[model samples]
Target chain A: MPLNADQAHYLFSVMRLAVGARVALFNGRDGEWTAEVVEAAKKAGSLRCLGQAAPQLNPPDLWLIFAPIKKERTDFIVEKAAELGCAKILPVQTEFTNASRIRQDRLQAHALEAAEQCLGTYVPEVSDLQALQALLKGWDPARRILWGDESLVGPAQTLAGLTPGPWAILVGPEGGFSEAERAQLRGLDYVTPVSLGPRILRADTAACAAITLWQSALGDWM
Target chain B: MPLNADQAHYLFSVMRLAVGARVALFNGRDGEWTAEVVEAAKKAGSLRCLGQAAPQLNPPDLWLIFAPIKKERTDFIVEKAAELGCAKILPVQTEFTNASRIRQDRLQAHALEAAEQCLGTYVPEVSDLQALQALLKGWDPARRILWGDESLVGPAQTLAGLTPGPWAILVGPEGGFSEAERAQLRGLDYVTPVSLGPRILRADTAACAAITLWQSALGDWM
Candidate 1:
């Protein structure tokens, strides 16, 4: 397969890979494959597939739905989510969300980089920013939502009893969910409000913690 | 009480607080107290104690001992550790650790800011960077250490069987612990090697996830 200019530069100049050097590659769908460099140049390169290195290992049917915050923090959420084995990432515009728009391509790139850095075979998809209300209206009730409820910040509410299945964790913006939005979520049977201990966590911290909790309790971590 | 110049600038210039503006204060020892601004200026300020607002809520006796990585990531570990309710933060220089030094004061400030942002009553102390071997030499066996062992990174070894008390979580640097260091740690009776998950996590992500797992299972979250 022919490599892109950026990939060629990375392999030839940055990584100092020469022709015949072997590298692992993944397409987020195909299992990992080892490809040997057939041609190497400053701005162009080609590789021949050696064989499958490892089978594709997709994360559990888990998703992270969070209200976007600042650019750096939003990137952080996507990166950590990918590293922590989130299958999909959705950036939602909550009533109190500060960022009205997000660079979806940038976030998707972050997810890809995070997966590569973490030696992950699968890269989670980063969805474009969407309205939280609209997303919830079309949500599948079969996939439960673990809501990080700020009001319930106290001793940890163990997720031990929860069954393992399709699930998503919802974290609000820095300003938190508005009353109307909270009411709407609380009224939904698919949502389960959970506490993340006594301290009030920031949006990013809460997202990471909530994902860790869910994974260790009911997701792949178990 | 007299406010420092930085605090004054923050209150008067950044926050735009004037006389009679009330703010919550904590000494990391005393309970949270409400103070009314008596004088406010660009470089100086004063306040009068109104009353105690909330009792001091100290986190459980849990410590985070991590090998320092890059500057921003080191800062991140401190901030997340504070927000996650760690009682103390210790930066250890491991055999394969990259950063030779860390600014203790700056990291302490990050912890303080994180505590304030999270509405935490106490700020975790950021200790000066020390050699891992040295710290382990004088280590108290009574306080167990939860080691994020990269070798065991397959399944989530549930922490449910462990008991909580004075405990610490230790995360290695990006290069991970040298084989000698790993051997020494594994030999220690108080060290319990546990896996984070099926994927390799970056240093920052591992720190946050390990803290979350320990907190949710054996720390105050219980």
Candidate 2:
């Protein structure tokens, strides 16, 4: 096993790790691997795998499909979601959204950085900007999406009441999900509409809270 | 009760709300108020409170004490915390914190706008930055302070299992709390070390998640 060019730059330039240093590596599919640097270069480096250090920790098959806000907030969402062990990160577009040009490569790099920071084995894939309608067209019933529907009007809806299954958390943009989007969500039988709480959370906050609730409720808290 | 000066500007200039139009207002103290423009003026507008529509809603007696980061994030935290209904906000300086200039007036305006947006009556007060040790010197044993201690290596602590009293959430800066700070935190009987999860969350994410957890456990819910 060897460190990728991007990983090498982060380890060397960003973190300043030197030659003959040990670093944990995981290919998302394989279990954790401990690798030591055999060669160090500014842009690229090489490492040799010593042994498997830890088993791969699978995410909860949770997808975080949120409408990206500004550049920084969008980056924050991806990084936080990756650290929180989300299996997939999706950027969707809805009405009233302040459209942003998605730099998919940079965002993917952020996901990698967050995974490295949290010592997670898996890096959730970030999807391109897709229209909300196009996303609903190919929805699978088995993957229950827990909607952070702020307008659900009460605190009765919570992750504690939802049945565990393959899941996704859909959060709207800053302006929030439109009336049409709400209608579409309400019509979906498999969409479990839940409120984060009585207060109105910003879109980013709502996503994190929803994930925490699900993780606390159905994920690995036993 | 009309919108504040900043609110008036946003409403009239940005939102283009015309004269005689109605807008909703809440202070988290009084109930939601329905107010109408008595005169057309952006900088100097007049409005008459028609009546109280919804009764006032109270937030939990919790405080948020965090080290200031960049200007925008500091503003974001103030805005979000106000909307999330924290009773008070305090800025603390830890060993590794960078010097951050505060625009108190602008932040106070942001909090007001966030409150108006969320229709919350109670707005949290933002405090000036002070040394963490000085703030805790006169700590009340009756009121517990929970630290979102990232270094806590154990099972994910639940806020539900913690005490229900006047509480504050301690979030260090990006550099994290120093060893001496950690020792002080651990030494206090009133200090409860809690984990957002096994993940290393950014300070902002930790604050939101910590508040959400506390709200879910002890605050108002169905």
Candidate 3:
């Protein structure tokens, strides 16, 4: 594939890759491939695909839906979500959500960077921010939503029994879900309220813990 | 207990707590208690402790032993370790570890902050940086060590059947363990090497993932 200006800069300026250097590439759908630098320059560059290096191996159909907190911490959530094998990232607008909006493109970049750093073949797509109520209205019942309910304090309720298929983990904002939102979530048949642990984790930490718990219980980590 | 200068600054300046304000307090050994601010100042403060509010709720006896990396990332590891219910945090100097020294005091402070933020009654002790060789020499055989082995590929090997007791999770440096270190870890009988997941996790992320997996499988989170 012909490299863009940013890609060229990353390769030539940052990575210091010269002509004839080999690099690995993956585009989520296509398997990882070996690409040789055919023409390398600071402004423009191109790579010729050599061959497939690895078959496409995606994480389980898992999604991470979380309310955006601070910019850096939101970025951390996206990065860790990608590393922890989240197939999709959704930023939700909750009643107590601190951030009014999120830079979806920047979050996507963060996910891409995380995937690259973690040696992940697939990069999870980061969706634009959506209202929590609106998201719940269009929710798919087939996909189970694991709610990290802070109100139910104790050891994490085991997610063992639920058969793994399509799943999502919903983490609330720092202020937690409103009573109405909590009631709506509890009323939903698809929602399975689970505790992370006895301690009340920060928003970013809760996201990571939820992902790790889900992965360990029924996702690819098992 | 009388507050130190830093603690006083945190309480009076950062938190903006007024005299007579009730604040939660814990000292690792003692149960959580409600304290009334008797004297408040920017440089010094005092609190009068009331009766215990909550009994001591300690996490399972789990230790996190990790090779020191960059300063900020090292601090992150300590914070996450405390939040994830690590009873002790041990920074070890491996052959390939990037950081030569660590501010044990600062890291301990980070752990304390994390514990306070998470509403944890117990704070995990952060040990001074120790040589990996010396640490291994005094290793307790009875306490199992979960080695986050990067060499072992694929999904995490389950800790399902393993009985919960005193345990430790060891995470290597960003550069990863040297060949000799890898051989030594593999040779240890108490070490149960496990993969966090299929993808390679960064040192900080690996520590969090390892802790989450351990907690889900055997720790108090279960």
- Which one is best on TM-score? 1
**Candidate no. 3 TM-score:** 0.95
Docking class of 3: medium
Where is model 3 chain A poorest over a 10-residue stretch in terms of lDDT? A153-162
**TM-score, per-candidate, Cα-based:** 0.97, 0.86, 0.95
Worst 10 residues of 2 chain A by lDDT: A152-161
lDDT of 3 by residue, B87-125 (tens): 999999999987778899999989988988888888889
lDDT of 1 by residue, A1-222 (tens): 999999999999999999899999999888799999999999998999999998888998999999988888888999999999999999999989878899999999999999998878899999999999889999999999999999888998999999789999999999789999989989999999999998899999999999999989887888
Over 4 Å off, model 1? none
Candidates, ranked, TM-score: 1, 3, 2
User: Which 10 successive residues of model 2 chain B have the least lDDT summed?
Assistant: B152-161
Give the true-structure RMSD of model 3: 1.7
Model 2 gets an lDDT of 0.79
lDDT of 1 by residue, B73-157 (tens): 8889999999998999999999898778888999999999998888788999999999999999999999999999988878889
Computed on alpha carbons, the lDDT of every model, listed in order, comes to 0.92, 0.79, 0.90
Interface DockQ of each model: 0.90, 0.43, 0.74
Task: Give the per-residue lDDT of model 2 (tens digit) for A1-222.
Answer: 456788778889998888899988788878689988887877888888999987787677889999989888888889878877688998988886787558888899899888876677888999888888889899888998889888874563545667777899999998788898899899999888887777777787788778878777776532
Off by over 4 Å in 3: B1-9, B13-16, B41-45
- All models, RMSD in angstroms: 1.3, 3.3, 1.7
